[model samples]
Target chain A: MNRSSQHPLRELAERTRHAGAVLRTRSLETRARVLYEALWALADKKAPSGRHAREALARTTGLSPEMIDWSLAALPIEQARLLMFAERAEDRVPVDLAGVVLAGNVFVAAIEPITAALLLGAPIVVKASSRDDAMPRLFRAAIREQDPELAEALAVVTFPGGDEDKERALFSRAESVVGYGSDHALSELATRLAPGARFFAHGHGVGVAFVVPPDHDADVTTITDALAIDVCAYDQRGCMSPHVVFVEPTEHVSARDFAIQLARAMDRLGQRVPRGPLPPKVASQQLQWRAIGEAQGGLFEGDGFAVALSSGFRLSPGYRNVVVVECTRDRFASAIDSVSRFVRVLAQNGQWVTAPADCRCCAMGEMQRPRFGETRDGIPLHVAFLKET
Target chain B: MSEEHKRRASALIARLAPPHAIPREDAWRARDAHLEALRAFQKAQIPVYGRLSERFGALPVDVLRHARATVHEASEDIRVFLTSGTTQGARGAHPFRDLSLYDQAAKAAAAYALFPDGSLDLCVLAPSEEERPESSLSYMLARFGEWFGERVTIAFREGKLDLAALSGALERAQATGRPLALLGTSFAFVHAEDAFAERGVTFALPDKSRVMQTGGFKGRSREFTPPEMRSLISSRYDVPASFVVSEYGMTELSSQMYELTLRHALNGDRAPIDATRRFFVPDWVRVTAVDPERLQPVAPGEVGILRIEDGANVDSVAALQTADFARVVDGELELLGRDPDAVPRGCSLAIDEVLSAGDGAT
Candidate 1:
């Protein structure tokens, strides 16, 4: 297809390879300039504003635009501040990541690591996810207009997945492969990859919101809104999305009331914005919660609020809507334990202020990833390739 | 419901009728409920609803409210199930406290499906016996057995398919040309097709032949499109693909959706259809076609998430939001596929891919 010529992936990969060299071998001043130039190129393409990227990223990561901007804007600062973490650099560790098999989630994933890849000059073969399709297509169009060589180096192609040969071939050549998928899927992928490769695997981890008894009369709306961040964001598709919301039935907001408010908040968003479907499995799950087998049960769901199945239907890994469950904290924990094989864990309103040790999800570094870079088996990141400050 | 009955017939006979025919008829046209009314067996304490009342309240309407309400007046949502299996899995135990209102859903469908043979020998793809309450397939087969009588078949045990007995039965059925209506899964049927093909036996099912391929398409090699599946079977038999219908089922609701291929739309044979589980959606069902991102419904016909509020399910508050994407065609939902843009993080890519691939939205 001449379309391949219109935006040659070879050229894109080459240019990206060049840019990556600059990113990896060049000084911080050069890195800063390249990022700034990339920004300009992005602007020249007349692609999308940071707001559009922000929204897309938000939809993917579940982080608000404000949060994204704050994060990205703070990226320069995070970089500068992280300059102090020179002590934490893993360059000293003997490691080599032959390539990173990209899974699209958010712009941050592509952009953040590109900085490191460019700086470290690592060869990365990215398999753009459908989410990245829009960004890369637009960006490729932009790059073609401004400069085609850079686009070629990126070699971002959309191949139908399950082409095991392609993936195995790609993984076979790489010393390290980084990717994100559900714990179940990622572990399977890990099995297929070179066993010796240092895997930067992102699978699933359960995210639970623990409601603490706040000292003040906290606005139920406030707690509900906070929980909504993890549920409604990305329509609860991200690993970061809250799967089970643990409320005391007596916390700052009663579990029943919290669920009601949460559902209302989601409804408002759904009506105002209407989140997408629940995850495929979750959608199919449509929790068939029965009180018959429960060790203890009895709770109220406020008007419009319904306690949902923890493992109900997941249409595209999203909530059909919210299912608010009311139970003892231990039961809640146990229930979560039953399903939280590999998922993110969240503590809302500083529930972390109480037994931080009891927090099921603690790898704080996993939090910011709205999409991609998820863990499948809770495998710790023994090393990461960071940009040279 | 099958407890006392299963004792009577060691072999549960699930009469095989296309969902498009039976439930659709019951839901759309049948006057069974109107001419011969059904009173709530338990009123607020329906027997169909068992322990759910403690958390959700009464039967029927309370279960509907459990998932439906405004700010929500229910609590402690629990495990999930598929459509046909829920009531039967746990001994016909409804999620609510009321048990008497056994399917208070007055038959709104009955005219569509013709029960020419009230009792047909049924072949199913579920477990032959009881299993963990969570086994959707097992519960589903049990329900089918309860509904029909003693003519039942199973191909599963310990979460594995029993292929040998299964192949032999299909072989016998096909070779004899026995007037048997096949019921089970699309995948299992496909396998049977291959097995018969290998044996050089033409599975020339009878003219009044019907197959109710349920949701449990487990134990199949690949996901076969309806057209492909039809071709595979039609190669051996003269039956129309229209007779091979898909049964859409979920554990959350005591309802099933069917892909009732048209026998002949020209013949004003539109039967009673379930408003909740339409061959496609009717006006009664409020569907929210979503964009997922702007968190808003897309332009009509544009693909988005499919959310439903069928009053048929409101009795149990089963208003649903799903990640399955679909395109609206003259109000009928053409299930395009799952949205791969976002699946839960770290979920198995293969299972996830299977969910997204052609489970595809248009």
Candidate 2:
């Protein structure tokens, strides 16, 4: 019998599961402290590993170095927030082995669930996307450097997606799994999990912004600058990143004027944290999107970004390409009614139309920085980890 | 349309109404003259195009979504062709004051491409235009049956494929020993393939039998690449691989593009069958690869979004831009489909990706 060959995930899962038992014996304060220290090290710009993470992520993630730096600097790694979530994990029975399937789309997407798992003292086996494993690997390294004892509870492994045998090995042992990707992918992963194992899916959703007619006292520069930050964050890749900004024509500025101003703002921001290298296919798509925008209304383009003033609204395939639609409040609601289900975040400067039920509303610039307790895709972060009765 | 503009438009349509063996330069001359006339006619006759051209500098094909793009209002249209609203919830409609030009253009192109040898029995796996007025492909297939089909069998009714009826059509073609043309959307063909597999049935239709499939899977069935689809259709229908033709037409344009495999084979030019398939436009339609940013023609052999000028689109805008990415090689289009990386790398779902799922072209 060729017994020498074993799936790598099997042993890794077993090791983490065993470590989770010991990890659970520690007080919630210690586990939270260990997790916070590691995150803090990565978030610190002065730290070597922190700088290395930004550089490594720039290479691995198609984002530019400046954008990577901006993204890393924006990560919400506050220890107080970590402790707040940690207190919720107190007196709860930790999951035996928590399986995490990370996607390559947004590198920072791997953080929250992994934090929830560790904060609850659950040993985690992470199946890092082959396209991006730097964040998970670097995170594990940070944990190892901070506390080797807790490092035993973390394992980051990489294999091509749809490797069912390896996926089965991880799914069979874990009591819970959190998968991220398109909805189709998450569904397939759910089918392969162990019978009783619970599945938490962070599927793809869209983000939109609304700019109401500003008050007489409102500053246009402040609004456009903040909105530009929301658009440029993650190169407009995150679900929280706004794809379209619906601007109401005020006595002060028209929608076209707003689009032109936003174009300039994107240009100013691009100079600071330039848009990343776009794949050829994305570049082609961007062109088509711009042409469509031109046909629909007018287009204002700049270095690495474009602001399209469209008569109607559609989500732009984000790489800092944004659509600015002018409409009344009634028209705005009607336009978004059909796509309300996919709307993740509705960013606005002031009170506009009522948001959809599952959508999270935030100020224009703060779309990407959701507070710790807020629900993602309608699921609270605290509920992500296993909870004991 | 105004009487003067309609008269000029009709004259242009009449000049390029047939698919003939005209020289390349001569063909371009006639098409360009027609394109010029059609653009002027559209801007003059359609109020919407005038407004759009003034506002946007050029009328893009996407403006077809606006009701006023049509010469006549939707309510007064002699016929309106609706797009498959697969990409977005809103469907684009191309309204016409007259259907004669559209019919003539469709028949001429299909005859030159799919039915090079006059009319044959057509087993259409799609609803007739009378049944589904919104589907332009359905309208064109129904026209194919009326103009050329000696015997017609529509196996698709009310959005479902009648497998028994389709089997009967195949059996009839075998019994009569006459060539048959099978036409349907790609997803319908996939369903037929599945049905045949389940029934343990395959057909060896008469010689010269061919298949014409159009449209993408659009999440309707299991997706197969173009080569795989060609092989599946050829084997399932027991036809020569070259006889399996794919049609590329959209609701926005009156003209359609077709692969030249069947035509070349019919002309006794036997090219070795490979995965590569290039669609040839009719003499009346000229396609150019335009850089989306510059809105200008790209260098030869470079891939860009397709900008098609159809002389047959007499009532609407002559110049239209399609989202499809392609390369124009020696007047033939090598469709690379939509941008594969159009979906962002982040967790945010692009609505276009969600709406046009399984949009296989290449």
Give the winner by lDDT: 2
lDDT of 1 at A50: 43
Model 2 chain A TM-score equals 0.94
lDDT tens readout by residue for model 2, A162-271: 87777888767888888887777787788888888888887777788888746453477678888999999878888777878899898888888888888988899999
Mind giving the per-residue lDDT tens digits that candidate 2 earns over B1-362? 45554454455445444454456677678667767766777787776567556533345555555344755556668777888766554577887878777887787777777888889999988887778988888888888888989999999888899888899999998998988999998888989999898888889989999999888875553778889888888888899999999999988888788998898899899787575789988777888887755667888889877888777777667677777788898888989887544343536776655665532110
DockQ of 2: 0.31
Interface C-alpha RMSD per candidate, 1 decimal: 10.3, 5.9
Tens-digit lDDT track for model 1 on B286-338? 45565543335678777765655443332243344444566565556656544
How is the predicted docking of candidate 2 categorized under the CAPRI scheme?
A: acceptable
Using Cα atoms, each model's DockQ against the true complex is: 0.14, 0.31
Ten residues in a row with the worst lDDT in model 2 chain B?
B353-362
Show model 2 residue runs off by greater than 4 Å: A1-6, A21-37, A44-47, A210-213, A244-264, A279-301, A306-313, A323-335, A349-355, B1-21, B33-59, B70-76, B352-362
Q: How far is candidate 1 from the true structure (C-alpha RMSD, Å)?
A: 10.0
Report lDDT (Cα) of residue A307, candidate 1: 41
